[model samples]
Target: MALPIPTTLDEITADWLTSALRQSEVISEKTTVLARTVEVLGVGEGFAAELARMHLSYKNGSGPATVIAKIPTSVEDNRNGSELLGVYERELRIYERILGEIEVSTPRLYYGDIEVNPDAASQLERIRKMERLPIWLLRLILWFLIRFNKGKTFPSVLIMEDLSPAEAGDQVQGCDLDRAGEALEAVALLHAATWGDRCPQERYWLVSSAVAPRLFHAGALGARRGFLKNFGRLLSDHTRELYESTRTDNIERTIRLHREVPQCMLHGDFRLDNMFFARDGGFRALIDWQLSSFGPAVSDIAYFICGSIDPGVSEAEIDALLARYHRALESAGVSDYPLEDLHAHYTEQLLLLLARMASVDLLDLGDQDGRGADLVSVWIERLDARMARASSGR
Candidate 1:
């Protein structure tokens, strides 16, 4: 039987959230209601039906205030087991520890929750019937149900300071050199601050011992069979050959590189989607530190460059950005690390990207039939072209 389609914010009301919040003890009945709204933001094309931001309003004794709430996407929760909540909780802890210690920007956290709301019973019932729903959709419905299920659960809500997107808005399409530079700068600061000797022992160890192993395991398992099977079904014969030629060898290379390379704290998912810019271009804030781990610095750097930059960005611009990144790292006192080593690490990072694109449903170029195929084809073409040039001693 087909499951019910996931419910939208349009299908839900502020009252639903308010009741959930009150019931979960995130808010009290005595708190004055100011305004309630659910803005569905950043619903990326993936099985992870994670909503990026949720805004809530109520009156304190002095005046009205707003808080941004985050709920885990169902796909992520299911894939990792019930420990997803623990991950978010740990993320908050790490964010708090590094807030003042690091140069990287992050929002001020208020509170977080891991409980279900008593009012979502009806919504949960509808969710149970849905079939063929995307993973993201399933997560969306599950979030509602989790919030509505009757029981006292700890930390069922988190309050955070609201950071609005830049007035100019997201520059996902155009190749803005200045913005690109700013993004790289932000990443550099993050990498520098999180490197060895600079970071706390606990933080560093978490990356090296826990996060890195989990990511490598997940990536390896998913790529070994799951990703190739799906990706092969999605590509044409010629495209498949290009992808296979560009992919399998690179995966082996990356595995070897992972064994040989020194590890550092890496933002596992460093992409444009996770970045927020200030209106005046004064600063850029990196969010979603849940996937952070100890790995090669090149991994984060490559992800940002490949995933953030527009398709039209020239090779010259890419080189310039690469130079800037190295300079930033050196200035941050990463003197012992050679530029050549960084470059090699970057190649390994690119291989990781190939593995990721093959293994996951995260990229959002467009619909699966044409746009997605075109985007994947373009990626494969770029990979093959770059590999050919390198082999030819370019």
Candidate 2:
């Protein structure tokens, strides 16, 4: 029988590692985790989950000396938010189902499992049936439902290769041009590989459209409100107007238009923070699949360029990066997508990304001292600069 998925670091015992690694064939049956030490990692980096680096000792045989373990966040609000969006399930499904078939550089998965709350599923179903309810009442009910579902155990786990010594990109610091080019090329590889016929359709849940629009509609109200509350001071007159225009109706229209484009796998959260750079100054791995979904390929590129690049980065440099990404995609055999079309798609995607930025408030950011707030502020500032430049015809 399978061992229960570990929901907390303490629950991730040596026995659990032995069993999980064995089941995943990361270790021979003769090799058992004799002892292990777990060091909590990603203190302020990961919002939807908690990560730990586990150093291990084996008996009878050899195995990976170190690995990373990911479990659902203990932060009550964050965990509940993750459940509401099916974040944990989506990530587990990606690692278990999609990663193997793709060429994107991701951590080697050792084992992964998720036990979604049946009660949560039923509750969502009930809410879906109540679409006739007044919008205000439905939003209020969902707000309370999110609070009520707090601290519920929806255990999910992933044990995977540890890309140690590789530095995680800092969102607040932003990415330099060379590194940005590398990251863009990497994402282009993902988009090109998953383009058109290669897109996954068997798992409808992996598509962004699979989730009911009402959930996003409800969430956008709070997201916009929260974003305004936190970063309104940083907004310029032009930027503030743009932010305000991301009303639910506008956001829905943006989403509808994006859906009209040819779809590909998007590393939905493709920002510097979710990437790791090898010590040799090369791209190592992309982490955080919690937001993986199928969408307009440029959506990922637009999100990264608008949110992750240094705000001071020149328009010419940004264009160079985009052209680099386009060249990489062409090299990878995605011939039909023209550079001009990519730029147009990129512009539309940036607006959608602006609306999506508000969703950052959905996670629990209070515990990060001030880094969480600072990160969001920096992202908005960078994006605002880009939009301002675009509006000025520069």
Name the best candidate (by lDDT): 2
**What shift in Å separates residue 289 of candidate 1 from its native position after superposition?**
1.2
Which prediction has the highest TM-score against the true structure? 2
| 217 Cα displacement, candidate 1 (Å) | 6.9
Clashes of 2: 0
- lDDT (Cα) of model 1: 0.52
What are the clashing pairs of model 2? Answer: none
Q: Model 1: number of clashes?
A: 19
Show how many residue pairs clash in every candidate, following the order shown. Answer: 19, 0
lDDT of 2 by residue, 1-394 (tens): 7789887899999999999989988899899999999899877777788899999999999999999999988888887777766788888888888888889999898898888666644654554576556667767876786778655567989898988789888988887799989998888889988898888873533655424455555566666787788777777888777666666455465557556677788888888888999988999999998888877888788888887887778887888998999999999989888888877777766666676677777777765457776777788888888886545644
Worst 10 residues of 2 by lDDT: 202-211
